[model samples]
Each structure stands twice: as structure tokens, then as C-alpha cells.
Target: MKRRKPRILTLYVTERCQARCSFCRIWEKGNPKDAAPAHFKALLTEARRLFGRIFVDFTGGEPLLYEPLPLLLKQAKEAGLRTSVTTNTKLYRQRAEELKGKIDYLLFSLDGTREYHDQNRGISLYDTVIDSIETARRLGEWPDLLMTVTRENIKMIPHVASIANHYKLIFQINPVFSYFGNTGLTEQDVKMMKEYIAYHKTYVNYAQLRLISRGGNSTLQPSCRAVTSQIVIDPQGRMLLPCYHHALDRLDTEGSLKKAFDSTLRRWYEKRQGTFDFCEGCTINCYFDPSFEYMRNQAALLSLSCRAKYAWLRYVERPIEEAFKNRKRGEL
Candidate 1:
């Protein structure tokens, strides 16, 4: 098996969010302290030293709301690492210029059309998202639109994809999963989602879908790369062990990110990773997505190959058809 170094870093920049979404509860946690700037400074350097140029993703209740986001992203870029930020786009307008060159990839959240998305968000911010999308385009930033699909909004999947199509941008879909006791997905929901993925050329994590049907990581043994391939960090500068959804422990990194990672507690967790009792039924994507590449199993490797094909098709497939149509029109 080829050794996999840490290539992705997920930083929950802040726990403060205003949008009250129906499917998620990250906003309900009120306001938690974001990791100290020093913590990020350490990570920006130490992480590059320990792990080669990692892909850092700044996520949150809404990453744009984090005050230190611009500086942190700038630092990540200066460290010569690729950076990404998955934002709700609430603060895109205010922070746009600040983050212009820092972010290599930017993902915007959408549930469905204006009405459905507004309902799902528990706020009338659908217009806000659209405005942000337009603004992003004006700035020459082509961002991917991500829809968090639930049973209620699953039917609107194609509609949202059309929105992405209308903009000539990439689209992504992720089925809603239980987190922090917020369980709404059912077996029927899983069936519908599976059926939906079968037809759409969008990005789908089959492992996550399979686990969703089995009621979590229950049937599948954890070959997780949660902490191995990508490091999940909490707002207060601690590394979430195993994965974020079923994190049994959090290791602090007050001084050295490398030393703290090498500590007794984290090492123990590393040794027993993916085998923890909670790890049995966990379907967390942040950990599992990166794990696919590091998989040593022959069966998993083949599955990865199929997923990679679709992932490639997702971006170019539609554009190729559009170009063909234009070429035909020109000939006519």
C-alpha cells in the first residue's frame, strides 16, 4: 500500500452563523470561540512542514463570518498550499475583495430554487445567494454550487442543477445525513437519493450513500482517512479525532501542531482509528472523501476508479454538449 500523507486540512474557522437551516444544527450552538490567530499561524507553517503542501479548506457555520478568515487564507497561500472555502455566501459581499486571490476553490451552498432554498434555510436569503453568485461571476471567480438534498427538496435536484447549468458553472449534490442528533434521512430517502444519483452526472459519494442506507458506517468497517489524509480541526484549535461527526476526542495544539499530533492521546487514537465503536456506523464525508484515494483494498480501488471517471465527467460533460450544439448551429 502506498503511504498517504495529509493532503487536506478542514478548518472550521468559526461556529457563528445566522441562517437557521432545517437540516443542519451548526448554527444552534450559539457562538463558539474560533481558534486563535496564533493557532492558525502555527498550522499554516507547521502543517506544510509535517505534511507536504496540503489542500486547506476553511469551513464553518459560515466561514465568511470569521474575522480572521482573510488573514488565515492569505497565510495559507503564502505557505504555498492550495486553499478552499465552502461558504454559505452570507458575507461574500463584504469579504469578497479580501479573499480574492487567497482562495483557490470556493463552494457556494444552495438547497434548491428560490422558494425551496428560502424555506430550507429558514430565512429569505435566496435573493442574497443569487446576488452573491452574480457578484462572484463579476469578479471572474467560477465557484461550484452545492445543494444539500433532503427528502423534501430532493425533487428539486435537477432544478438546482439547471441553475448551475444556466450559469455555466459546476454543480454538486450531498444528501442530508444525521449530525448532532439531527436525523431526518429515512430508508425511503436513501432509496430516492440512490435513484437520483443513478441518473445525474453530478458528483456523488457512493460510499456515503451506501452507508446512509445501512443506517451509517454500521455495515462497513472504517478504512477512514479522517485524521490521516485530511485533518479536521475545531474552532478552538483542536484536531477532531477519527472524524468530526463521531469525534470521541479532541487533541489541543496550543504550542506545536506536529508535537500535539504526535502526543500520546492522538497516537492512541491513530492506532485505534476507524475501529472505535462510534466509528462503526459513521458516514462523515469530510473524513471519508479523502480516504478513498488512500484505500489499499482492491475492491475499493476499483470503486475509486469509477468515481474518478464521473468526477471528471461532471465538469466537462455538459460543456462538451453545449459546444457541439454551437458547432452545429454555425454549420447550419
Candidate 2:
């Protein structure tokens, strides 16, 4: 069998952000430098050549802080790659129109209701986020919501789901990682999350809900595709092999991009075949969700079945239901 190239690339376009979230340490330690646009373009080109089929995500402390983001997105699209961005939605409100055609998906972070969101994100920007969502909708841009579930905001899942439903946007729920200085979820919290996802699976995007419910440090998996099917690159251009959890095993991107990637791949394979102690207990979704074929466990079967059911609902049932409703209103 041929080795599979990474299918996803997360680019930290810049290091500056407006919000000082309670959980994130990025703000506490200030970012004094931003990645150059030329470096970004070069990296994207090499990335495209390495991975024939790729999805590039432009993330940041806040991607909007980078002025050349539009140019970068345009370049990636012209290279025949799909592009996406995850933002806090503060700056997007002003530039959604400019970004409408460039980005395939625009993800907004919505932790909870106004009070909850304001409290968790450590800023009074809930109303601004709402405005940005409305602005994107008005400009005919496809916007989605990402909810980082923590003790402070987990109870507001249903409310946030309703907001996504109201806007007809995709709602993605992810549990807060313990590495971020936040308390990890308890057994009770996990149970509540499972129940909530099951209940609202039909109300929002079924695929995303299913992904979130199955997320976290899953013990049923054999290996991860960190270097094979997914990777995260910091703004300074170093690549994180395996995942962000193993941040120490970073490959410098100062020389030949292909050479660096090959070395990283070798390192990843060695880790997998050798002691393999590092891969003992980790279930980061970015590494697991997209690399399901490598998971020889019961959760893999569950993932497939859940995907099939949701795929049918999203592609077959929802369209028919919408058409019926439209015809009933004499609009179809």
C-alpha cells in the first residue's frame, strides 16, 4: 500500500488576537511577530505539491489581524485547494464581504449565550460576534459556529445549537483540552455531553454533533495519522508532527519544504514502530476524526454507522422536507 499524504493543514497565519480568553495562554504570553505573507504562499505551494488533495485552514490568535489574509486565501483557491478559516468573529464583521468568495467555510467561535460567552472568552464581545454572524449572512457568506465546551459554557450547548439552527449554520462542539490550563471534563460532564449531543443531533448539523460526541481521549484506537493525514504548522513555519500535543517534536521549515516533511514522516514512523509509548493515551479529535481507517476499534464502527445515518439525513431527507415546506407555503 502507498503511504497516504496529509489531507489537512492548519496554518497559524498570525499570532495576534484581540481577546484574552480565560483558558488560553496565547494572550498571556504576547506575540511580537507575525508570519510573512510570502512565506505563507511558499508554504501553501509546497503543501499542495505534497498532498494532492488538501484542505487548508487559516487559523490564528485571530486571523483577521493579518492584513494579507485575502491574498493568501485567493492564492490557495487558485492552486485548486479548499480553504477555511476559524476566527473569533470580531474583525470579520467589517471584512466579510471581501472574504465571501475567497473562503469555502468561515468558522466563528460561539461559546454560549451573551453572558456565558463574555465570561469565558474574557471579553464583552458577544454582541460583536452576533453582529459579525449577521454581517456574514447578509453578505451571502457561508459561516459556521464552533463551541469549545468547558465547565463555564457546557450547559449552554442547547442554546448555542438553537442559534446555529436559527442561522442555518453548522455547529461544531469540541471539549476543552486539559493542556490549556482548564480543568478537564469529569465523568458527569462527559455523560451530559453525550446526552445533549444525542438529543440535538437532529436539530443542528448531524455530522458535526456526531463527531463531537465521539471526541476526546478515546482508548479504542490503535494509531493516529498525525504525520500522515493531518498536521499543524505554527506561524514561525515549524511543523508539529503527530499533533500539537507533542509540540517538542517540531521540524524546522527553514530549508527545503519537501526534505523537512520527509524527515518528519520518518520521525513519525519511527515513533509508531518503536517504543510507541507516546501514543499511549491521546484522543485529540483533529488526529482521530479524519483518520478513522487506522482505528481498529469499536468506535470506528460507530463512527461509520453514525456517518451513514447523518449523510442520509443531510443529503436525502432534509432536502425533501424543505421542498415540502416550501411548496406548502406556495414558494415552490
Candidate 3:
């Protein structure tokens, strides 16, 4: 069998964000240094040559705030790569026309009703997300709702899911990581999460919900597949090793990714990921969700026979998944 190439690229395009969110500290980096469009041009070119098939995500303190995003997205498109963006949608309006056809996937955040959302973000922008979703739909783009769930905003899951359903979009929730400073999700929060995702099986990330419910990224064994199929690039053009969750070190991006990835340092981290002292009880979804995968039928069969949520998935969810794929492919 051939070695698997990294399938996903997450580019942190900028380190400056307008929102002062309670859980994230990226905004405090202020006006930091990072790549210009020329750097991204070179990086994307190397990425395309190194990995025959890749999915590129442009993220940031606020990717929409990055002035050269349009040109960058166009460059990736012309290179024959799929592109995506994860944004708060705060500045989507001003860039909507230019970004319309460029983004292949979009993740818009909605924590809860206006009061809760503004409080969590330390900014006032609940209404902006709603309007941005409408705008994206107009442009033939269906952006999902990604809520950062913590004790402060866990109750918003259903409300956000309703927004996703109303707009015909997927709903993804990520539990707060302990290192980001929250005490981690309480049992109650996890219970509520399990129940919601279980009932809303069709649209929710059912597989991820089940994993996190069992304590995400907390096992001792190397269940993570980061080095095998994913890489996260910071704004300064450095790779976050193992995964961005436990960035033990930053590898230089001054050379071709193929060489950097195949380095002995990369090999060491890949083999030793789940053994670190800090890895004992880690539960960062950014690392776990992307790094985990298995045979679909294996889980489906077990769940169909025993789990209530997946029972329905076996009988009814496949078509729903198919329709979603069709919609994602612009067939519906």
C-alpha cells in the first residue's frame, strides 16, 4: 500500500481578529507578522504539486479581514484545488460578491440568541450571521453553523440547529478545549450534547458526537491520524506538528511541504503523539474530529443493532446523507 498523502490543509491566513471572544486568545496577538499573497501563492503551488488531491481551508483571526483573500482563493481555484473558509461572517457582506463563487465550503458561527452570542464573543454580531447565511444561500453556497459549545453557551445547540435546518445547512458543534482555558465540558453539557446529536442524527456530526461523548482525544493509544492526513499552517507559514491542538513544535515552511513532512522530526511526532504527558486527558475536537475515521459499515452495523440514534441512521439517514451530498454538489 502506498503512503497516504495529507488530504486537508488549514491555513490560518491572519492573526488579527475583530472579535474579542472569551474562549480564543488569537485576537490578543495584535498586528503580528504573516505571509503576503506571494507567500500563499508559492505555498499553494507546492501543496498542489505535493498532494495530488487536497482540500484547502482559509481561516484566521478573521479570514474575511484578509484583504488579499479573493486573489488567494482564485489562485487555489486555478490550481484545481477545492477551497473553504470558516468565518464569524462579521465582514462577509463587504466581501460577499467577490467571495461568492470562490469558497467551496463555509462555516458561519452562531452561538445562540443575540444576548448570549454577543456576550460570549464580547461583540455584537448575532444579526450579521443571519444575514450572511442568507447572502451565502443566494450565491449558491451553503454554509454550516459551527458553535463553540461551553457551559456558557451549550444550551444554544438546538437553537443553532434550528437555524441550520431552516436554512438547509449542516450543524457542527465543537466542545471547548481545556487549554483554551474553560474548565472543559461538564457531564451535564455532554449529556445535553449527546441527546441533541442523537435525536438530530441526520444533520449532526453523529460520528464526532459519539467520539467526544466518550471523551475526545483522551485515550492513550494513537487514535489520531493528523500526521497521516492533515496539516495546519499558521499565518507565519509554519506547520503545527501532530495537530494544532497539541502543537509541540512548529516546523519551518521555508521549503517544500513534502520534504518537511517526510523529515525525521515529523516521523518522531507521528509515532509518539498519544504518549506525551499532556496527551493523557486531552479533548480538543480540532485534533480529534479530523484525525479520526474508520470503516463506515463497522460503526453503522453496531449502532443500528444497539444505539437508538444510529438505529434511525441505518433505516433512514443514508438518503438524507445522499441528499446532503447532492446539495453539496449543487445537484439539488
- TM-scores, all candidates, are 0.86, 0.84, 0.84
> Candidate 3 — which residues are off by over 4 angstroms?
197-202, 294-332
Colliding pairs, model 1? 217-280, 217-281, 218-281
The models' CA-based lDDT, in order, is: 0.76, 0.70, 0.74
Model 3 lDDT on a 0 to 1 scale: 0.74
Ten contiguous residues minimizing lDDT sum, candidate 3: 294-303
The digit string of per-residue lDDT tens for model 2 on 209-249 reads 34444443333444455666666788888787656656656
Give RMSD to native, each candidate: 3.5, 3.8, 5.2
- Candidate 1 ranges beyond 4 A from true positions: 1-3, 184-188, 197-201, 306-332
How much is 238 displaced in model 1, in angstroms? 1.7
Candidate of highest lDDT: 1
Model 2 residue 114 CA deviation (Å) reads 0.8
Write model 1 residue lDDT over 136-202, tens digit each, in one string: 8788687888888877887787777787777766777776765656664676887776565533446
User: TM-score of predicted model 2?
Assistant: 0.84
Pitting candidate 1 against candidate 3, the one with the higher TM-score is 1
